[model samples]
Target chain A: MKIAIKLAYRNLLGAGLRTWLNVVVLSFTFVVIIWMKGIMVGWDYQAKTDTSNWQIGGGQYWHQQYDPFDPFTFSESHAQIPETFNENIANGDLEPSLIVAGNIYPQGRMQSIAIIGINPKQNVLLLPTQKLDTFINAIPAIIGLSTAKNLKLKKGDFTTIRWRDSKGMFDASEICIVDLFSCNVPAVEAGKIYIPLAVLQKMTGMENEATILTFRKNKMDQQKVDDWVLKTNEDLTKSIDEMIKTKTFGQSVFYGILLLLSMLAIYDTQVLSIFRRQKEIGTYIALGYTRTQVIGLFTVEGAMYSILAALVSAVYGIPFLMWQAKVGWTLPVDASEFGMAMAQTLYPVYSALLVISTVLFVVLITTVVSYWPSRKIGKMNPTEALRGKIQ
Target chain B: MENHSIIQIQNLTKIFPMGKSDFTALNNVTLAFQQGEFAGLIGPSGSGKTTLLNIIGSLDTPTKGTVEILGHSIGNLSAKQAANLRKEKLGFIFQSYNLLAVHTVYENVEFPLLLLKLNATLRKKMILEALEWVGLTDKVDSKPPQLSGGECQRVAIARAMVKKPVMVLADEPTANLDAANSHHILQTMLKLNQELKTTFLFATHDEKVINYLKRRIYLIDGKIDKDILVDH
Candidate 1:
């Protein structure tokens, strides 16, 4: 078997220029898929971690009132939180929530910012164990650096929360920024002012009500969570219901376009790779190689190219993606409405499984595409092939 | 079934289809060549001479009639069986010296021997002897493209005989060569025929090739026009 391979490989190497061109094309395609996938995955992770878009507790929950005339109510009929939710929560399988509220602050110019309410003890425990000061034990709130700069409030300085009540009544209250901290989320970078959730609820006059729940662990089945959230919001006010539906559709459409474009790039590269090897292939078949051998030979060759390309992509793609995950890639000012809705800065997520799957899928597609031309070469009449002929 | 005859053909016909019409390339041709005989197939272009030689060489199947070579009927053999038969019993030297361009002279001579599953030591010995017989022993590592026309044809002849097949088919073997180169190839082929007792079959339009044959068969329009056994 090795000897046979050695022979085939030698013949493959005879056309050095063609082989190199194939490798480059394959590698380029591989890089494109990986890079694009990294961007998409990055955007998704950033969106999920935004603390506003996706709820933090593995997932989110919402409730609706029974009628439009009724005041906003959290009713079980609107959405049912699985009974297993608390069990998973207590067992550390669920992530702790970071309650976040958004409002506009006016200085010389008006700037929008987010206020995150954190229980220092619970927040520290839920986050990845790190050396940051415990927020629960400290009285002063920890605000993100960017958020502090934007609001012109620093550590030991006082800021105020202002908002319209449910009756359209205006209200305002002064709060103090105790510390400055930053998280991986880009949205948090610009607009976060962390304080005690209890304090914010009182100041906003919501008493014991929580605005949102956030978590690091995404243990909830995405489909189940999405369905429950949608069902719960179905009976909400028309405006609120429309908001959720529009958000979901908008994200899906953006992601779909990204996937379609990546596939087209991969396909184009593979076609070019195969087209360049026509003469080399005819030579192999003329050497008494069966069609099966020819197919196997080229398929393996195509796979090698994909693997090389994927490896190159992954080496740079994974780390680059991870770095972007830690920080983020910000979109331009002229961004689409959907991009604006996602985050100012988009971070990429790294999944080993997704990378592996991408590599395998690219290889499979390349092999499949290479087969048509390879089989055409394989089935060529030996006489014509031996005559140094190709069409 | 003469003791000396290595191949015999009887009433062989080959029909080829060309663009909605059928043409008979070889029609009702019959002849025989003995072992060690240096014979030539002489005809004009498309006289069915190459077609008859291809059938005898086991490279093509006859549309009708039987071709008996080395006591096996060519018609009854499977494709694989015919390929094996060609490998073992027949050798071919084409006009263009159809040597695989990528392989060296020695590797080309050793090719048919590889198909026989011979050990490397014996294969090397036989290949060296075949190359030596053609006076190409010093050019072992050179590829076909580097060789002169005569040397290339010599390598082709060496390849055909390295397996020690019973008969060799020469399809216009000197067609691509100059006068000196053509004479050198013909003489080398004749020397191998004499020394190895291998039968030689030639399909050629060259009068020079006809002059060297002990017997000549003239073909015209897919029919055997004449067969003259010249007194050698």
Candidate 2:
């Protein structure tokens, strides 16, 4: 087996031009796949983590509907806070909570902002290596880095905020800036502020109002988490059937076309490479190798190409994604609300699990693409092969 | 054919279907060579000499009839089984020498032994002995591209014989060489045949190759036209 593999390697290496060309294309594809994967993975991690931090925990969460007309009135009837919520929090058995309210003003000049309220002490239990105390002090306010920068609100400065209450009432007040924070997920990090739950209740004039109660588990099990999400989605659809019209079929169509184009590029690379090596493949068969061996060899060759490409792509791609996570990709100022919402997006956080999964997926795609052409070797007749003939 | 016959072909036929017509590459051919015999298969371009050689080498399956090599029927062998037989009992030397360009002369010669699953020390010994027989020991480290046409052919021969196969199938082995190189290659092959008693079967249209063979079979249009034995 080793000898056969070594010969295959040498043969591929011998045809330097074809091998390098294949490697270049494969590497390019690998980089593209890895980059897209890393970005996607980064986005996904950022989304999940931010969702957990701001509102959604891995499995279940809650979102509130704020009245746009009256911004300061408290209406307990419109809010959904289970009676056991306070008991769960006091017992320290409840999932984390991410209380978010839009149109928050952290300065005298009003701007569209996000306000997140959390139990500072309990927040550390959900996130690793994070000290929620850094964002709290005697004055106590945790604001997004972008929001603080834009508002010119330093940690020791005083800031005022205004938002609509549950009863469609508007209210305004001053709070002390405590600390600044940022997340890789752009949507949550910018234009947002974090406050203690007690302080948020005082500011909003609601004694027990929360935008969402996020659950944080000790372990991250994907299947269980997804199941919980599915259950929640099912509940949401059952309760709010009219909201189903908001589902974006156009987005699915767009992504489907994009994915098809990417796959086509990969397919073309494999087809061109296999076509060029038809003669050499014939040569291997002539040398007394079985048709199975021929297919195995070519498939292995394609795999090798993919593995090499993956390595190079990984080397560069992982770091780039990390950098994006560390320093978010910024968008221009003066953008629309939607544009601003997406402008300074950071890469999803990096995970070893995600990277390994990406590589395996790319390898599988490469093997499948190469196999289509390599199967032709199984039909080759050795007599014709030995005569330097092509089928 | 006797039990000791190294190769036996009984009523072998190969018909290639071309569109609506059928082309017979090898038609009802029956032939055999004994152990240690030097045989020649002479034919024109499409006379099925290579097809017969391929069957004898266990590289291809016959369309009809049975081929037995070293007491085993070719039809009974699996693909891997046939590969093993070729690695153990049959050697091949193509017209182009087919020396893998990246490999040195020694490595090229060691190619066949590597397939035999031999240990490193035994493989080295066999390769060295084969290279020495072909007078390529001095150029063991030279790659195929670094060697002349004659040297490349010698390396191919060394690769073939390194496994000490029972028989060798040479398809126009000297066709790529000039007259002098061709003569030298034949002399080397003849010397190896006499010393080791390894059977040799040549398939060629070249008269230069036929003159060097002790026994020759003339094939025309996939049929044997003449079988001649020369005075050794």
TM-score of chain A of each: 0.50, 0.52
TM-score of each: 0.68, 0.71
Best by TM-score: 2
Strongest candidate by lDDT: 2
Native contact recovery (fnat) for each candidate is: 0.00, 0.35
* Candidate 1: tens digits of C-alpha lDDT, residues B126-232: 99999888898999999888999889999988988898878888889888889988888888888888888888989998978988898899999999999998885
**lDDT by residue for model 2 (A1-391), tens:** 5876777677657667766666666556554544554554454444445444543343444334433233232132124355645565665545434344545444456776656666766642333213335543343666666667778777677766676655557776666776666543344556666667666666666666565554454432223321122224234223222221222243335444544454455466556655555544544544556678778877776666667667666667667766766776554653224412222464545467756776687678777876777777777766655554663
Note the residue pairs that clash in candidate 1: A42-A348, A42-A349, A56-A214, A56-A215, A120-A135, A120-A136, A121-A136
For model 2, state the Cα shift of residue B227 in Å.
2.3
Give the backbone clash total of model 2. Answer: 13
- Which tens-of-lDDT digit does each residue in A161-270 have in candidate 1? 65444344566655555666645443344455566655555455554344333333444443444323422211212333344456546655754554445445444544
Per-residue lDDT value at B42 in model 1 = 93
